[model samples]
Target: MSEVQVVRGEMQPWTDRTSPRPALAALLTDVVPANRRTLILGPHAPQLIESVLAHSADVTILVRSVADAQQLGEDFGPCLQVIAGALDGLQTPPYDVVIASDGLDRVLGYDSADLSWSERLAAVAALAAPDAVVVLGLENEFSLLNLLDSRPAAERHGDDEWRPLHDDPSRPVSVEQLRTALPWTAEVYADFASRTYVRADVAANARPGEFPTRLAVAALEQTDVPLLSPAHEGVDTAARAGLLGSIPTGWLAVIGAQPSHDIYTETADTVLTADQNLTGWDTTISGEPVPATELSFDPGVVPATVSAGVSVESVLFRLASAEDVPGFRKLAADLGDWVTESRVVLRWDDVVYDGESFAHGVSGWVTEEPVEKEDLLAAAWVRFHERLVGQHRRHPWPPWMLGDDLVSAWLGMSGVEAPEQTPATSPDTPPATSEQVARGKEIARALDEVLGTATGTVDVRTALAEAEAAKHELFELKGHVYGLERTLGFRNKAMKTRENRIRELRGQLQKVTAAHERIRGSRTYAVSRVIFHAAQVRKPKVVARKISRKIDRKIRKR
Candidate 1:
């Protein structure tokens, strides 16, 4: 369908149903899916029980519940609301038109909820009978709408790296929020607020005092009832009842740190002027009938006939805090449809605002370049590794792989070679020397790393040499330690024998220690990123045979 009709500003005697998205019903009529089962087929679908009731009833129905769905005179049709736990066997398809409305979107869009969006949708979808139509509604631009339309609001910015700003002072509940919060079309209860900011020194700081600086003959407005001008500041009790001096009207409320007025005031409602132009539009939130009880966004009324200059017309409700970055960014997104290039300014305390409006003097401050994402991940990884090493050094499994034997089986690092392996001992026997255990651990770590990074052709003899001396402890095959898990007889006895061998190793250790002394002295621990040779366990026998032949040839030559 073409865009629906849209209405703007205060209601004019002349009405235009001409536009595609009528500003009033823009969202409900077109935005939502008009399927058979709007909500059941989706969380947004209307209730089957309510849908059935609305289809055949002329009664002023009150489908009482959370965010009650009531049709006073049936201007449209039906509505529904199924609270989370109250949905007794919700899968039983009840309604033909299920409208999930905008509420479900809030659950899905931002925070982390128990059930994901799709999960919720699936539950609702399964409820549908065959061919049941499910229509779900979500505010595509949720945050933006509030900036341009909501009343009192707040937003947060630069609160923290993770949670910078929240509860923005600028973002107001949007007309949609109002519709969902209250029970009316946003336009029915509101007006497009146009104000020329009245700066004490400069031209209007915000707006509303756009035209007419002071009173000449104050514009008189009457809604059959006397419509007082909101501007004049004279203390005339006599004029107070019937005559309000020189204030232009058309503001519902104002909310800020030191608001010009109270949270709400009545003198802002639309009063008919002699010229028939809209004036003094004090918005009434709680259904107050009199101007005395009427609340406004700002406190004081505007004066009549002020100087006119650069004029700006914008959406009526902007209750968002200018300081809330995410919220305002959301609002900027909503208002983006109504305003030009939207942005959210966040103050990173001990930090600067980074922006791009320098040409307009609307630029920002930049203290430093933002941190990169990779740096964050790297930092997290290092911290995790350190924590694991600290807490699990004695574990036979490497701290890095965590519990994933498959993945841990392939982790590697540079700059470390296997230390010579000693032997292991059981508790029934004397505990093995710390030196022996340390050597085995070092070799194990090195072997794991080599497997993880090894490449190219296999070198057999070197592979056998690098194998652990405790190999028998893990293998049925002697002299070799395969990467397989769970060996049978090899563990206990082999470890004992290896321990015995190390005990007998006392004499050989001196020679080995002499070689180690020289080797340890020259140890430069620098890593060479060279490709290591792959180990082919079987080929060691072949290579050994060739070595023996070369040795015999060398002996004959000698």
Candidate 2:
């Protein structure tokens, strides 16, 4: 078995926070079966682990960090076994479900000298029962976005040891590569931001119905720009040009045979997960199962009732025919534009239909975030106005039908008071009196003159004073800046002068020390020193006579 680190006590409280990177929690819930023996290869995410535990499934997590394993063990009690080791060391009875949320190539130590990537994949396959499902997550190195970003923003900082693990030759497998690696053919899904996954073919087709990430949509709205970066523009262009599969950010490959799971039927209302309502049939419409995206509100075509003061994430509108699909898309787009303009957000999931106009067929609009009913009502009014105005231009509706009462009712739903205005008459209607026409023309000329000039121009004197004050402030700031520079220059010169003086003193001191060393080492000095020492040893008078005789000899020679 590989090295093990065991953690077996209480851990710090697990406070939930939003994950900055895309999370696979929602996708895991959809794919993994309930009440089964499941094994997770990595426990990097506590929320994902907790979400799996919520399904009443027996789960085992294999983690590299003992502390993380210990925390998982502590937070989840005996039900969850947090093993601290590599995948190679894991030994257990065959599991019904195995999930490698942290890419398969990474867990295997692809570049390690001990094990090859293929061997690691085989080792993981051995852990799965014959009928068990295995899910593997992988990054797309060739993702079109990857081309735009050679080095990710996250990795620009120095610590990048993890990059090699992901970029190893064994990883970021293509669909064909995945087929070759796994024993059984798998269903490969390409994902956006690791959250939005679609069938490989569907993604590659780049249909108009494709939904973008909420963050992406929100960013576009903020900039009031479409496709700001090359990466952003690449995705849209690729999807439109049927090249999404060729360049996906990540892949979720489900290996082994897919098992049948029971559908949930407890609630009449169907809630969507990860921007998708996975339940094929709506329980609210009928107990019977219908293969449609929306519930069949048949037998009656009354407008769907949305309760006030309640926050909703999505609303379904049944379309009359497939011919209306394009028109419905237009309406959805218009609604999204209006919502964004209001600084609110609403995203389109897709437009789906099943033949019967009033029954199984429906078109859905999803909000990026849950919004109040009033906001939804305002969005609906915008949609209505677009539709009405468009039709009114080509084939006009009678004034009464498009009158104040109708507009007012729509506005009242959103707590807005509709502005009062005279109903517009048909263009073919009779002309007005000559006197009335003359008065209208005069009013038009006067209004044009007022608008032609700048109506809100400031007083010239006030503007001049403000500009003059700004100039004075600029000059004062420059003066202070100049004074600071002068002071710095003086200090620099003084420092240089002190350094030069120190250098000169050091030169003079070195010369004096050299001369003293030369005098002490001379042969004559050594002889004289010896004679004086000998004289001193004999008598103090003899030492004085020897020093005087040496000085006289030296003076005579000079």
Candidate 3:
């Protein structure tokens, strides 16, 4: 078993937990010399160490963390020589191949001398032989990630960032500066988590239809954190401005000997390498070459053929941003025709179009499931609609036309009627299952969040406008309710007045009936009734005269 050598004071409890980078490991496989003395500086992934060991028999690793050193000793056994100390205390022979891709920040111990970034770089360079191949990484302080980072300044720095030395004057900021700082012929790459690397020169010269720009955009999009703005916009803007290479998250410099490929990227555990030709890329898994056409990243999801062409998403964005309805409609119709003919489904950003035909981009994603033409068209437009709205891209559609309505209009332009239920799901479009609809919504929401306008998340102005509208509606409702109450109160008072008049009339009729009954029941009233009947029979004229007089008296009283 290999033994740990403590050269000076060591950081006992620390261990670098940086994720392993398969793309970086694959790159190392090309540059590391066969059967030569190699020195790996700082904390690197086990996969990288294994890659270096595959090419070299004698390997030495220098780490400031004693825990990491001991773990390496146990993992590699006699194949590796582990040194635990600061970079200043290491005393070793010149190595034919030197790797410090983790950078110089974490290599300093608590008891070590305070060294600037340049001084530490010089110290690492001193350990390299005259003809050695050196692979070094330098983190960019002004990276696009740093610029878009939404975290506060204090939260961004952690325990490992105790001595970042980001303000050192002699430190290089760009790929060109890094190249000039190195002694040997250097090839630098814009490193994005070591999962993807783009040649600096290639990225700097990338156009809208090129592979480097697409790769840069894709790499920048592979983040799970909240950012101040979308990284893809920044990348695209920089690429268009011919300044993409100027804002790398980090730069990986290879000295003395360059790697065989211009770019290295790992997706779905498969490492893909591409040259400057940009025509195609080769994929490998577990050191064995995999047929590019058959490579699948997910179950039932096949990868599209890699080619060079104009990104459909970029074209759509341009048309929308310019508010060119005719141009956008034409493109949509053409795109719909292609999808109908090809029977393939891919994201707009993943699909590309040449002058003659549509093809998939170099790293395009595709699914194998057969989808209806209307569903496919609706899916495409839905995604486009989300991006256009979420990013606040100007379009010819009315401002009130948003979400599904906007998508439906866009679909209509392609001559496909949107489903009455929803753009994503409709009984007419039976091919789009419930699961598919849900997934599509999920993807749309995720895209919205990435664009910094999530579902139900409105801007301050929109929120205020909605609030004002609600307030106005409430006020109108309150006024209508008050009017109804007033009407009800008037009706109630009129009914009460009629009831009092009816009660008074009933009381008067009751009193009149009671007086007549009492007079009839009395002896005088009986006799008077008998006499009036006799008079009606014997003296009809006299009875008529008495009745007329009584009627006159009653009329006078009224």
Candidate 4:
């Protein structure tokens, strides 16, 4: 093996308070497996360091600051090998994994005068063994959220170093560019709100209006919702509603000799869109496909049993009543035929259920062609509407009053079409009659009344500003309360000390008073007093007479 090159620089010491963003931490922990030799580039996030230390062995970190090296050295002791210097000449052995989570662009890209992004990445890659994996977190320059919000929303830049070169922010390096730069097969994962990563495979299956910008709209409007979890805001709802298909917020690139473990795990039953586009059952998860089993309920208008070798549309199984079978099947077939004739190109993959033996039933069909976003949903709705109408005719109820399931399925499929940008109107419109004109006027008046009652005005920008000010005030009050609490604690301790001292002095005073009383009652003190009075003898007789009287009185009393 050749000696490794070490690059040293007089870099500024690490000073900014930094911790791992949850998404970055998740990316690192997912890519770098346990008990493997790992090298962390830059000391941006301490949490990432701690995670590597806990999960891997013989951890080596390449940092640029002496202060950072000393701090990290003291933190991990002999367990970590902290190297403080430039990246151009680092002499180290190739390891199993190399992680450049935060400030990758700065650490090796522009922060170093000697290296470009390509050179920086190469230097880091040199430390990785042939089979070693490299994981990097990068900013998406054309991030949809940033574009939509007209602000910097992506977690791409760090405070450790300023870029030496200025580049167009609008023209970020494409995924293809990244793939070409790094050695080995590179897989990029787009980070969703910096919480979870959405794979590009799943993203390729997206439909219109469900792209990253539109999905982020819900999250941005409801700003209080946290970005760390996809469940917050409307991300989970949007994912279930089929919005994120083609783009993601940011990227985490994994490069190595071959394909490594996926950062995310998806199940077979997962739904990626509202129109049954990209269901989990359609793709093999973790390299294994879920097997099809016999559905128990009678498939009303569909197949009774799906054969193992033959492929069909995605299936949703449920138990249904026997009475509703014939009508449901007839409607489904009519819809399937109509949809096929209309160029929607779908096959009714059949609903199969065994009412006599089993309880489970299945609904949904396979499509013969790629799902077109426009027509498939309308065809499904027409079929559902016809089925609902037929059921209503028999039950003496309205179409909307049919079985809840039938109504819901119809509504869900009906909503797939994006609303028109402009109201439909014809240039050669027919003139209205007097009666029609009067009715229109009355309707307009009613609408105006409704609008007047329903609407209230708000200055959105002003409200947001006020809310922010209130938040800052709340934090200030919290600081003041914390200080008051500390002062109270100190005063209480002082009061306790003073009380203890007072108790000690009281005990000493009590001891001194007892001693004074003992001394005054002694026989020596009484005899000395008598002798002194006798020596003063001008009135010795009188003094003697007084003493004798007192002695006689004491003897009588005894």
Candidate with maximal lDDT: 3
- Show model 4 residue runs off by greater than 4 Å: 1-7, 108-111, 148-161, 168-172, 208-247, 257-558
Greater lDDT among 1 and 2 belongs to 2
Give me the displacement of residue 555 in model 2, in angstroms: 99
lDDT of every predicted structure (CA atoms): 0.26, 0.48, 0.74, 0.48
Runs of candidate 3 with Cα error greater than 4 angstroms are 278-305, 341-344, 364-368, 419-558
TM-score result, candidate 4: 0.41
List TM-score per model, in order: 0.19, 0.45, 0.76, 0.41
| Model 4 / residue 207 / CA error / Å | 3.6
* lDDT per residue (tens digit) for residues 420-490 in model 2: 44444987643332222232233223322222211323333334556787899999999999999999999
Pick out the ten consecutive residues of candidate 3 with the lowest summed lDDT: 291-300
Off by over 4 Å in 1: 1-89, 105-113, 129-134, 139-558
- Model 4 Cα shift for residue 60 (angstroms): 0.9
| Model 4 poorest 10 in a row by lDDT | 310-319
Q: After superposition, how far is residue 494 of candidate 2 from its true place, in Å?
A: 46
Report how far residue 62 has shifted in candidate 4, in Å: 1.7
Best by TM-score: 3
- Candidate 3 lDDT score at position 440: 44
